[model samples]
Target: MGELVYGLLGRKLGHSWSVPIHTALGCAGYRLIELEPEELPAFLAREDIGGLNVTIPYKMDVMPLCDKIDDRAAAIGSVNTIVRRDGKLLAFNTDADGFCFMARRAGVDFHGGKVLVLGSGGASRTAVACARQLGAREVVVISRSGPDNYENLSRHADADIVVNTTPVGMYPGNGAAPVDLTAFPRCRGVLDVIYNPHRTALLLQAQALGIPCSDGLAMLVAQAKAAEEHFFSRSIPDGETERILSALRHETENIVLIGMPGCGKSTIGAALAALTGREAVDIDAEIERRAGCPIPEIFARGGETEFRALERQATAEAGKRTGCILLTGGGAVKTPENYGALRQNGRIYHLLREVGTLPTDGRPLSQGADLAAMWRERKPLYERFRDTVIDNNGPAEETAQAIWRDFCAYSGD
Candidate 1:
């Protein structure tokens, strides 16, 4: 009926990638319905809805309206996907399968192992249920004031797997972690359900510790795939998830430009932003603003260590943002800690330019230093860290357009 309508039901529909995700799967009619609590009943009562995905503040609310509930959704106490089948709406918990997919992607097997989950909300339920389904021996549901809360978190040092269903490090509040992964030395894997920044501080820490870790992006895509299957009544190739995932990850993630000073990061970043309609940020400028002094003056007054501290702070601030073209200082990659901040929500592009041609007039390190030696030292790091390389030997606009074209191609925007 009525061309089969489908959409996402949420209180705040901003910053959702669901529509584009569904579009990628060849579903062109998806809409995002932002409904107040009172609005949900009438909306669910409508028979024309082909399917709907439930988000925060309404996942549990949509359950009672369903004619039938999937066992996993009932067990999880949440309904994230609703399909109107034969005029009767049936509820299902795709999050359960989604979390399972996330864990499996992280190489975390739940075969009678200790599992610690942060937050006892709707998302946590699926994580707990899925962990149990996969044969997790002990599933500790941590809450704010619960018995296994973050306060007494250290007591659970035996935790084999840690899952963060909390919003601790989700966007705006980036760089903050709920608990220290080092506390649980036995932790073999870590997972955070916050997909905005893609990689949370917890996941970064887990990665630093060489523990297998994954963010909520995989789960987000996997759940969307499951919902698509229910709506279209078709079996999708398992490999489809990965192709969509890679495209989404590259597109949704910010595009960061890293190179030596005067290698055209700022120029190319601004040009790229102009071409793509995305914002552009200069990390060196951000550092100077935070430090209340010129970058050259900061280097002169406080030494390179002081400048690095300010750079790290600025880098973390930039990490919280998404879809911006970030132009970072050449030496930003020297400090390994900055990698997490830069990579949390972006992909690095090494702006390769000839050392002799790079500007050095106002740059402190580049002005009198052996530019050749500096390039030789940072060259490998730039090459190793970059997801793509932008050769800035040509005109700035041309280089920027090249990057814009590639980004649009990868993201399909």
Candidate 2:
């Protein structure tokens, strides 16, 4: 027999991490299928498919195709998973179960507490349902044109809990927040249903305010576990969710490379990108592109202070983008201000290589400069920021491969 084929159905799937979630549950052969509205009908008619998970605009559209939907799915008014049982297509909403799991895991007791829900989309519907199920005192659904929208958000200033189900803080829109958490002084906990950034801007704000906060990663993993139970006809260990979450956390955290001048950060970044299938970005190159000048010219005319200013701006921008292999400049760790932003979304790794073997072609700091003195000056800063050390005394390929293996081990990929 062939392997069981299960997949998530959506229009755009570039940002999905469902495959890893399912695989983490010991289920394999998961696929992601992007279908147009017209393509969905034909695809649904095919019974050969093992299981189909729904997303976005198709969640409601799939109701007619289901033979039956249980009370949980009926109450949520959305179906996220479809499985065949007794020759009938059964639709289920694992999202509801997932939200419950997430709430429990977060130690949030919504009972008799006013809840503020952001957005009025499909995710909002499910979150509202979950909140009500938790016996919330009142549930406020905020939409763009709704009476309780962001414009009139002051109406719910006394809310006890906030749940963001919108895509405002999702990847590519990382720095955006639907509403400021400070508006609700009574807010006890915050949840943003955005898993990509792991630590979203909203969550970060809540954390900064000493409020309990969590990202949608738990809900995602919980929902996948629920779907996996349906797919394989088994219940996964409760501890499995956290195990998977820990892995996903590592996977989403950026693999940041910081090192001395000509320590092969750019080369190692490219190799790591290839080995891990994650995008690699050279911060200095991005800085140069934005400044419209080479590092040498920037130093010659604008001096190191001006160059550091541009570097800081670039680093701040790059820190907001998740899942990238960031190759930072040699002096990236010298400033303490850069550490908080960089650590927000990345795991810093210091690439250490012998000073004699280091090249000095385009780097202004290394040209005619004492390599020993530079390393001596920057070693403490590098040690301060790095989550791990990457020794590149061997071949660049060897160092890259070693980093890749260690990254996977750390991330449980």
Best by lDDT: 1
Off by over 4 Å in 2: 1-5, 255-282, 289-293, 299-317, 320-341, 348-413
Provide the overall lDDT of each model, using Cα atoms, as 2-decimal numbers.
Answer: 0.86, 0.84
Candidate 1 residues lying further than 4 Å off, grouped into runs, are 1-4, 264-281, 284-314, 331-337, 349-358, 364-413
Tens digit of lDDT per residue, candidate 2, span 253-329? 88889999888898899888778889998899999999898889999988899999999889878987777899899
Distance (Å) between predicted and true CA of 278, model 2? 9.0
Deviation (Å) of 77 in candidate 1: 1.6
lDDT (Cα, 0-100) at 360 in candidate 1 = 87
lDDT for model 1, on a 0 to 1 scale?
A: 0.86
* Candidate 2 TM-score, C-alpha based: 0.76
- TM-scores of all predicted structures: 0.81, 0.76
Q: What is the C-alpha RMSD of each candidate to the true structure, in Å?
A: 4.3, 5.3
